[model samples]
Target: MSNFLSGISITLSAIALAVSGWTAYQLSQLNLLIDQQQNTITEQQNTNTQQQDKITQLTQKIEQNKALISSDTTQQLNSVSTTSKAQNNVIQPGQFVRQGFDNKIKIELQSVKRIQNPDSEEKNVVVVQMRIRRIVPKGKVDAISLNQSRGRNPETSEVYRTIQNKSTSFTYINDLPQDSWGNAYFWLKVPEGINVIDIVIPETAIFEAVPISS
Candidate 1:
């Protein structure tokens, strides 16, 4: 009876050991599965972040494109209108013309001349002289603001800066009393072959296709 009991004990011990080994193997598999799931989640998150960045960049580009289109359209319309008005009223050198505004402000183109640049005689410059007169005694306008005017080359669609030279005589229009006049000058450095240039005064007037006399 003792020997029989000893054999049974040994068998039972072997079975328990096998069961423990199987449990350990199952636990190791479960841990590996959990690690794989975590790695997959991390990769998915990285992909989503990259997609969001691309979306933001694309949105910004779209907005920029819209603004550029709107600006271009407005410029085109203004250019067309200016060209038409200038064709009808062409002012030549040594000629003076008056343009009335609301019967209150009287703007005159005193002269437009092509002169030799003092700094470089070979390079020609176009000079525009203008006079702003207040007709109505009750109204006041800023005449020195003419300095912000710009010149445009209709042929090349390029905008030029108005240089203030020694010959430029501009009076502060805001300082002038009512029923007074002020003078301003604009100088443009243009290419030798450019025959015509346009002047655009914001909210004032557009002088289009003025011939550059040599």
Candidate 2:
């Protein structure tokens, strides 16, 4: 009986040791599973953070693009407005017009002849063949004789038999030569409100200023 009791005690001890070992192996497996789960959560969180950062960057880029577009649109609008204003301020002719900048009229005289008045021996009137080269719009033109000695009516542009009637504002034109071009001369005049900065006449008239010989 004593030996049998001792054998039973040894068997019970072996069974307890087996149970403890099995429990320890199960605990280790659970710990490994928990660690895996934690790692998966950490990876998901990192992915989400990266995605948010990208979204923020994209949003900033969109805002910058919008701002640039707005600025360009504003500039284009301003340019159009300025161009429109300039066009509206333009002036036309055949009416009263003002001359801006250094505007001038040019007239060319083709055939100039000295006409001696039979009644007046000392005084002579000049006839010029003239043509219009260029004139500002709304400008007026009439024949003018270049003798201050003759009587002149500034309003009617008429000449009378007086010593002061020699000078004239009107120009005379004659037919060109047979081989020449059309026969016509020009006279230059400026309209009211427009200024005659300068008058350029061709060198076809006698007693006119001579150009430098080139």
Candidate 3:
């Protein structure tokens, strides 16, 4: 009886040990599966972040494009309005127009002429002459500022400003003494085929449909 009981006890102990080893193996496999799942989740989150960044960049580019379009349209409209107003207030060449500032000073457009270049016969030059005189002797005022002189093609409505160089010329009376006369000349270059152009002195005067002749 004692021998039989020892055999049974040994068999039971072996079975218990085998069961514990199997349970440990299963637990290790479960831990490995959990680790793999966590890694997959992290990779997916990174991919989502990259996609969101791309979307943000695209949205900004779209907004910038819209703003540029709006700005360009506004500029075009303003240009057209300026061209139309100049066309309506046209003056003949060689005709004089008087302009006064605050009853203190007076200015006159004396004459305008288109002449061939003395040195370069191929290029044409437009000349404008003006005279300035003071109305008030004791009045203290700043000198008149001539900002820009521009030429516009009638057919195309293209405007050309004076180029500052040796070939182009600009002379103006900055300050005039009381009862004294001052003279100024402005010269500009024009294309050969553009015979009719509008001369514009912003906020001052417009010489409309001025003919260009040799």
TM-score-best of 1 and 2: 1
Best by TM-score: 1
Clashing residue pairs in candidate 1 (N, C-alpha, C atoms within 3 angstroms): none
TM-score of 3: 0.43
TM-score of each: 0.46, 0.43, 0.43
Number of the predicted model whose lDDT against the real structure is largest:
1
- lDDT of candidate model 1 versus the reference: 0.70
lDDT of each: 0.70, 0.44, 0.67
Alpha carbon deviation, residue 69, candidate 2 (Å)? 1.3
Q: Candidate 3, residues 1-214: lDDT per residue as tens digits? A: 9999999999999999999999999999999999999999999999998999999999999999999999999999989997765554344433545555555655566555566776687666766666667777555545454536688898899876664552213332235766677775567777677767777764455666765544
Question: Residue by residue across 1-214, what tens digits does model 2's lDDT show?
Answer: 9999999999998999999999999999999999999999999999999999999999999999999999999999999997775544332222222221123233343333334445665224333343332333434333323332222334444433323433334443321122332333322222222211122232322222211100
User: Residue 121: error of model 1 in Å?
Assistant: 3.2
Position 179, candidate 3: lDDT: 64
